[model samples]
Target: MQQSNAYIITFSIILTVILGLLLSGTSQVLGPLQRKAEELDTRKQILGAVVDGETLRKMKANEVLEYYQNRISSIVVDIEGNKIETAPDGSPMVAEKVNVGKNYKMPAEKRVFPVFIYHAEGNPDAVESYILPVYGAGLWDEIWGYVALKTDLNTIAGVTFAHKGETPGLGARITSSDVQARYQGKEIFDETGTLQAVAMQKGEGKDYDADKHKVDGMSGATITANGVNNMVKNYLQYYSAFLEKTKSAKSSDVVALN
Candidate 1:
């Protein structure tokens, strides 16, 4: 078989084009499913902040999505605590579209905040909890989590932390039930009603004044603990407007009744 260099080059070019097209087609076909899975996983993580691990383990993807849709009501707000449906130019203010990682790099004044309110069954107005998203630097890379606050907005109801590359036996311990449980009943506000983001004190937490906003840090993860401390505080400040507004309304109601 005698083939000129030009002929060989043409054949190779055709084969390359065909392979590229096939890959593109495959990606087109699978893209939606992959995105669907990712969505379900995110919903699961958000649910993890509220539901128990065992209960979540028994649920399927559709169930997770349904749980999110039914139990969670959400809003998108800017740094100033004003509700935004779209940008100042009138686009849809999609809560799910904001990327915290990207927003983190932007100036604080330019960041958009998303708030998720979970309501108990059959209670439309009675908010079960307020779930806040938080992320920041860990010892190695980035770490993030969801923290659910009681209606009082000061007491922590539940917390779920995850990290990109924290130390397994130390920093990564934040994900442990025992570690997170320490946050339960901890207040994020001081006696004077000031927002005092919860701190992670070194030790067994027995030394920490939990009622006054302190949690025990991971055994040997001081830096990671500090990251969590800052993360929670940052989010607390971001959410202050909504929290304070609700707190004031409830307090006013009590005064009227008395």
Candidate 2:
């Protein structure tokens, strides 16, 4: 009986060590591939947000590479609106800000990819808009997305919301086509130049048109939607100087090229 007990203990130890080795090896082998997959998924979401249904369906990593190569220009900008450096073509670059409490423990230089999609036209004045990257914390996890606005930087052209995890049918409403569509063509700034963060207020009694920059808050998910509203306002405030610069450039007919 003592020998049997000893054999069982030995077997348990051996199994534990074997499992540990297998897990470590598997993680090492799959880490790069996992990262690559995430990168591709992010690209897909960004492209889907900007492109139409047909165009987005046709988009692949190689196609996205070509599109970015031909039209987009990427540059890293610091918190103070100073341009840091132009990133390498076709490489994913990180934003200069980090959200620590939201599980992004990485340094500012390591979190969030800031990609700029430039609209190219035969006539320099016909260029469309600039897309800015924004991210922040939701109730349960990290929320991230791209917001494309017109050249004026006052009107939103499109937005895409993605989250790590949030209550289904509640916070998840942020990613719904209907919810996201509400942000399309919404004004980001009032004529008085005040930034009114969009809200998901309850009831239809509130007048959004009168408010100019207001949006109807998501029903049943007020808190999560409010989180989104705050994120947009705060993140955009950080880029105010950059937006001002871009607006100023528009007045002076400065055209960015790839």
**Candidate that would win on lDDT:** 1
Top model number, TM-score: 1
Q: Superposing every Cα of model 1 onto the true structure, what RMSD results?
A: 3.9
116-219 per-residue lDDT for model 1 (tens digits): 88897656577889888887998998988889998888888888888889999999998777788777778888889888988888755465652568877777
Full-model lDDT for every candidate = 0.82, 0.66
lDDT by residue (tens digit), candidate 2, 1-258? 457888999999999999999999999999999977776666655654566535756777778766655555555565555665544464444432223234235554433335365567333335576667777878898887777777788888777788879789978878776677667777777768776645556643354655556667765777777778877887677667677776787677644532
Alpha-carbon deviation at 67 in model 2, angstroms: 2.9
* TM-score to native of every candidate shown: 0.81, 0.76
**Residue clash pairs of candidate 2:** 199-217, 200-217, 200-218, 201-217
Give the 10-residue window scoring lowest on summed lDDT in candidate 2.
95-104
Per-residue lDDT value at 242 in model 1: 73
